[model samples]
Structures are given as structure tokens and as C-alpha cells.
Target: MYVIIVYDIKVERVNKVKSFLRQHLFWIQNSVFEGEVSRSEFQKIKNGLLDIIDEEEDSIIIYPFEFFSEVERTVLGVEKSPIDEIL
Candidate 1:
């Protein structure tokens, strides 16, 4: 499965969250990460994120897909990501 992770978290825990996620996903832009992982790995990601974020003050959205090709995207300006695209 492929997953796109977007997080809105407190500044204090931002680095922790980013470092943890960097071990598993591609950092496409600020607070946004996307990549493919096994089902078990995805579950671990969920559990790990839960451990790192405060439920009361933070929010994380994960979009899971069967295939990355299913997405339709448009870029309007200069891109800041290290990778041009993932498909």
C-alpha cells in the first residue's frame, strides 16, 4: 500500500515526528510525506505516530491507496521537494 501523511502538530514535537517518519517515508514537502510500505509497516506507523503526537493538540491525516497511479496532481509553481514526483 501507498500512504501520504500530512500532519499539523505542535512546534515542540515537530522534529520528533519528522525524524520518525523520515525512517519510513519520502519527505515531499513540509509536513507532508508519501511512500509505499507493507501492511505491517503501516500499522507500526499508525502506532508510532500515536505515541508521538498529543491527541488534544495535534492532528495527522493519512491517505492510503492501493496504487499511487490513482492520484491526479497538478503543480502550479516552483517545487520544493527533493524528488520531482513519485509514480
Candidate 2:
């Protein structure tokens, strides 16, 4: 599945979350990531994030799609291509 993960975390732990997500997704913007991940991989990512995030002070939003083609993306400025495939 294709996934878009956005997060707003406390400044102190922001880098921790950012780095964690980078391992599983492509960084497209400040707090936005998009890429493809398998079900198991997604679950692992979620579990990892849960361990690192402070639920009361941070927010993470994940949007999953059945197919990448189903998403309509628009880039007005510099275009950062999403990862074509997960290795």
C-alpha cells in the first residue's frame, strides 16, 4: 500500500520521529512522508512510532491507499518524487 505519514512532534523529540519514519518512507516536506510499504512493514512502523511518541504532546497522521495511482498529487514548486519502490 501507498502511505502518506505526517507528524507534529515536540521539538525535543522531533528528530527521533523524523529519523524513524525516514527508514520506512520518503521525506517529501517538513513533516510529510510518502511511499509504499507492506502490511507488516506498516505495522512495524506504527509500533515503532508508538514507542517513540508522546501521545499527549505529539500527533501523527497516516493516510493509506490501495494503489499509488489512486492518489492525485500536485506540486507547484520543487518536485520531490516519491520512492518508486521499497527495497
Candidate 3:
């Protein structure tokens, strides 16, 4: 099954994390990254990530959702939807 992994990380460290994944991963997107792999590969990716990230300098929160509904349920106001939407 396809899954969506959403991450919220520090602004400065975002680019470094994105760049690292782009080398070993496909389907890269803004803040959200998606790809398909075996269970073993998935575990390896997680471990590889931890090795490079510096906890004092940056932090990453990752969540794997089985369905789009779960993602939609957490939606905040859209950025372009309105000027006052976030206010």
C-alpha cells in the first residue's frame, strides 16, 4: 500500500534533509515525501536518517498514514484560500 509521510522540521535544516533523501529516494515533494520500498528498506532508511541528523541543530517529526482521509482530517487553513484564513 502507498503511504504519505508528513514531516515538520526546522526551516534552516529542511533543505539538508531534502537533499539527503533526494539522493536515495524518489517522489520528493515540499515537506511531504513519498516512495515505495520493502519493509527492510524502510527500516534502513529510518536508521540512515538518524545517523546524519543532529538533534541539537534540527528535529524531525515523521508520520506514516495509511489513508488520505487521515491526512485530510488534520488539515489547517489553506495558504492561498484567503488572507484572513490563518488569522
Index of the highest-TM-score prediction: 1
lDDT of 2 by residue, 1-87 (tens): 989999999999999998999898888888999888899999999999999999999999999998898888777877665444432
Worst 10 residues of 2 by lDDT: 78-87
Query: In lDDT terms, which candidate is top?
Result: 1
Task: Kindly list the per-residue Cα lDDT of model 3 for residues 1-87, writing each as its tens digit.
Answer: 234454556776677767766654553346665554466766776776677677776555555555534444334655332322322
> Model 3 compared with the native: what TM-score?
0.51
Question: After superposing candidate 2, which stretches have Cα over 4 Å from the reference?
Answer: 80-87
Which pairs clash in model 3?
A: none
The order by descending TM-score is 1, 2, 3
Record all residue pairs in model 2 with backbone atoms less than 3 Å apart, i.e. clashing.
Answer: none
Give the higher-TM-score candidate: 1 or 2: 1
Query: What are the clash counts of all predictions, listed in order?
Result: 0, 0, 0
Q: Number of clashes in model 1?
A: 0
| Per-residue C-alpha lDDT of model 1 across residues 1-87, encoded as one tens digit per residue | 889999999999999999999999999889999888999999999999999999999999999998878755576786667455653
Name the better of 2 and 3 by lDDT.
Answer: 2
Residue 15's C-alpha lDDT in candidate 1? Answer: 99
